[model samples]
Target chain A: MIALYTALITGAIMAGLQAASAAPPGGEFPSKVPVPADNPMTPRKIHLGKQLYFDPRLSLSGDVSCDTCHNVAGNGSDGLPLSFGVLGRVDRPRHAPTVFNSAFNTVQFWDGRAKSLEDQAKGPLLNPIEMGMPSSGAIVKRLAGIPGYRREFARVFGGKTPITFEHVVQAIATYERTLVTPDSPYDRYLKGDKNALDKSAKQGMHEVSDLGCASCHAGAMFDNPGLPMGTGWFRKFPMIPTNPTCATYVREYHLADDPGRFDVTHKQSDEHVFKVPSLRNVAVLAPYFQNGSVGSLRTAVRVMAACQLGKTLTGLQTTNIVAFLNSLTGKFPVETMPHLPETPDSTSMMQVAKLQQNQRQLN
Target chain B: MIALYTALITGAIMAGLQAASAAPPGGEFPSKVPVPADNPMTPRKIHLGKQLYFDPRLSLSGDVSCDTCHNVAGNGSDGLPLSFGVLGRVDRPRHAPTVFNSAFNTVQFWDGRAKSLEDQAKGPLLNPIEMGMPSSGAIVKRLAGIPGYRREFARVFGGKTPITFEHVVQAIATYERTLVTPDSPYDRYLKGDKNALDKSAKQGMHEVSDLGCASCHAGAMFDNPGLPMGTGWFRKFPMIPTNPTCATYVREYHLADDPGRFDVTHKQSDEHVFKVPSLRNVAVLAPYFQNGSVGSLRTAVRVMAACQLGKTLTGLQTTNIVAFLNSLTGKFPVETMPHLPETPDSTSMMQVAKLQQNQRQLN
Candidate 1:
């Protein structure tokens, strides 16, 4: 059932992607985000997705959720350098990217391993270091057992067989798509509101282009928007790094340990190459970069200048760039915590006991 | 500054407690719950508390929150046998009691250690196996550093020093006091609506009284309301030991491991003595008892009858009782997730990194 649903959605997504690709880039940011035909947003689906996103039952320990790391309240990131997973059992290899404005991104994750938001949602559930559900089958069984979720799935899917892993991801992806943070000061300035930006921020915006920052961090999203959604536009970090700032960051931050896109493709050329992250709400979300190694935005700016562009920025220039970055802090949507539905049986209890038993066996 | 505020509030709480104790216990369950005069509910304070309640930043791993255990979505309990704490690092010694209708309880926790909800909120933050903050000072410093929180504190507290451990707990408790699960079928029945309860439920209600089940589980809240808030009314679990079912439950569930109120009082008589939890919403919150050992309501009903009353109920009686319990489920208030404020500095990052380092060293 899930395979059929996935295939059906995939075909619809591919067609939508083609249509999205034909549209010219570098225009005013659309208020309405592009939605795939198959997984079109509905009130019920979004509500269910919100519940699932906040629910920790997705994890083995029943203590980790999508919001555990990508907190909607705290600039869509957990505000941790490395995310703490179930029972703080393992530190996630990379920093949790902000979910705010993620809908605008061409691809998901620092590695771009997952293609769409739907694809991205599935990775964390089964990742042993993340949510850590033993299998998709286990998740399906657990969710299906819950009476409230059964009703919801039936209502949303309108089928005899409603609950599936594919539908779960689709609902989650639909919710993720709604997480776009629109109407930032930068966005207002782009829309011909000259006075929207401060003097320093205005100067810094022009300076960013002059410094070649806009070459990659282009378009309304400040990511390479020309690339199709769920497609990577990889760039080599520390491209020309001989500076003391860049060298110190690499060593101290444990950046070398993660091979970036190389971990996904297993290609030498992909080494150190990562998808350009959207600069939206970047000021509030720090320690900067893939590893979350740098502590301050000013330090991150100085290092990025040396490593990526090889142009040493002055203290004043760094300060202005930071101000400009701060202007990207868009208005966040009000996200109320949804009251989740309860299970009628001991399925949750039995599942938890099984998980605890597995943990005991491992120990 | 915090000391001054605490002293002032303490005086007010004392006065309120005096008034509360003087009031007769068995009035038509007061539609309005008495609020502590000191930590009175304000829109700002309740809003702040709601945010704090859902915020995982309260946890050491930055993963767990009050909502993690007392989920508003699922009858206020996490629906787990043993509530998972920081990183699933340690299994909580007892099942997490539901936050719903908790304000009506005379005491907090299964052990009945904390007096008021304000007192209860502080336990998890410093508990090694719970939220696991290193110290109270650490929590204060973290919240103080966040500019938005600082402003909110100043607004809510109306003082130069707004961010304190006392204020944090006070706000959380104030919000918790509002989590009253009123308007249940049982509540309506209690208010003289004869048809409020179903035929089975009405029969079960009579059966419960006949079985002397209402001795401890008494009053409007289904807890002993004659006692003042925070005062313990302890009853020995598994009062009778001869039954094979009771013996098996004790052995299989490791029920003896948790010393119950004995751990708090160090009195031999306190052994296996737990606070009588309210029957409100009990049907939906399964895996019954302190150990969460019994998965089904039927099993729990049988165990409770054999152990507490020394009377094994028939299958029909148990089903009817379960129906009666289901009638206790109440309407939950629409609780939306709050957008938490961000820290202006890397204080959160530094703290989490320090905690991770400490964990590594301890391991």
Candidate 2:
């Protein structure tokens, strides 16, 4: 074991270090992600969740859809600094984070307000600023009004809890778990094919550790390992002094006023301590940071370097970081994504309700 | 040439007469279909149109998408005598037509009310019972509101016409033209490859001719070579003594209220003079006739035989006709259809306007 001690330090450092930038270039993704026995993933639930995602009826204005912000083909995030919510086309307080790998977060949201992905899924629906659904009961009522959803929910979650916010969240959460990014260049490099990463990408990865980003984004999930609320890695991100709401941070071009964990806990120490987001597909996801205050990948690295590590990154270092980030963009999963439903079901209860509503109004 | 002298009158009739059930197959699909220059077919336009065809936005209730009744998969028609429309959850008025080769229609729709596929495309959107859009203007407004849609329409249609109803129809018509069903076993059999079709299917095809179903459903595109509206044969269909609305056939379950062609023209001669729908893929497109009163392919054939040929079909004939109809079922081009715009601009704009309106009220 002691034949060559040159590997000792590297092994020790690498043992607990996350392989975030180390995955196969082109590998098969799991046909399906596993779910807890308590919440099984059925085609019915996924189908229901997909409908909910696309259904504008879920929003208060009957306009905002989940797919509006998290476009499946548009690299998950809607390529905006911040997403627009209901009431008006007002920008959200924070960036619209990618839905990918969200299942791994023990606590969801930048502030870790929600305890699980299910809880997180439910948050936007009830948020007056987002979907503006009157309440979870209202959401259930709307969903129940659609007969197909009712039938599907009954089939998947059992006939008992036919319609509930909990069921909706659970179904959505199950679907969310399947949104993992897979088979990036980093992954290929890690699987023993060293040529997967170009020279610059490898150099950039070395700089990632040197810059201390690994301190927070640490694990296969690229998030702090399931540390809830007060227990996780904590660091105060920079904030402008004068903001009364203390709600978000502001940079030169973009606004960065995400109070992060502070808004949820109201603890002084929690102020600006945002949950570290995964860097997978970070190259495509611009307007980085909790508030999306950083417009570019390189600038985001710079901000993180200056604000968290108290060091300004060199221009080359920033470019290298971006190059490394590009390595994390995963393979597009075409096979596992569900086929479009063969036909639009006219008999769907949602259709029935809409028809009834139209008839009644006309009469 | 002297080729005409070798054919005797009796010999000519026997040799020239093709089975009505069987069409000349084993030929390549025509490359040019006389598209108007303004709406030329390109790979991009067809691709975009296909997506729009399958998308549900064409419907008002957010259910009953285009593919609902005209099934692109599952043999190109919803296996129903009459397919439901918006609010027609339990009962449908007319049989959903097979879209396999609807592009060949000289005048589209069962009534021949529309002069072209483009005109036919607009029918459903404006029909109160079909898509149920408030107005063509509303549809244009809705589509124009979506950024992705704007981009796509601009790309496909040369420029944005503010996403007018015309654009929608044209796009759909363009897509529908590309849906020609591919070569079937019958086509190969017709190519002098006698072994292509099974003994039973070929035998059934001969029976189809003897029964005279091909008198109307004829040629490469089917229907009359000259008259697109009338059945292309000499024999008149049986009529009810009570009304000329039965000019073509005596049938129960006639929506006597809907005089197919008569409603469009207000002409007595047009009464019951429904366009002769090609029987290709009729096996899959069940619930036949202007009013989809017939439930099965066998029933449809029997009804046609009894009314047109003045002969009551035996169970054996019905089965044989069904076999022949099944021969028409073949492969259809399938690719990813267009998705509804995630951030529909009209919806978004309406949302913003509503917000402003609400804010003003609040103030």
Judge candidate 2 against the unseen true structure and give its global Cα lDDT, from 0 to 1. 0.57
- Using DockQ as the measure, which candidate wins? 1
Off by over 4 Å in 2: A1-363, B1-34, B58-64, B80-92, B159-165, B226-257, B337-341, B344-363
Best by lDDT: 1
- Distance (Å) between predicted and true CA of B264, model 1? 1.7
Error of 1 at A326 (Å): 1.3
lDDT of 2 by residue, B1-363 (tens): 001211112212322444453443212232335355567678877866765676545555433456656656445565444444544332324556777677666666767767666777777776666666668886777666556678888887665364667778778878887777756555555445677666667767777666666666655444543343212222222333344333234535453435667666788766656777765555545446665555455656766665666666677767766775676655555444343444311232222222223333432
Per-candidate DockQ versus the true complex? 0.38, 0.06
Off by over 4 Å in 1: A1-27, A354-363, B1-29, B354-363
At residue A299, candidate 2 shows an lDDT of 62
Candidate 1 all-Cα RMSD: 6.9
lDDT of 2 by residue, A1-363 (tens): 101212113222343353565421122222334345567676778766765665555665444556546654445655444455543334345667877656545466777777666767787888876667879888787667555566777887786777788888887777776667777887666555679888888888888776677776655545553343223445566633344322222335333445668777888778767766776777766656665545556666766666666666788888877788788877654422232222112222222233333333432
Cα deviation of A185 in candidate 2 (Å)? 11
- Per-residue error at B165 for model 1, in Å? 1.5
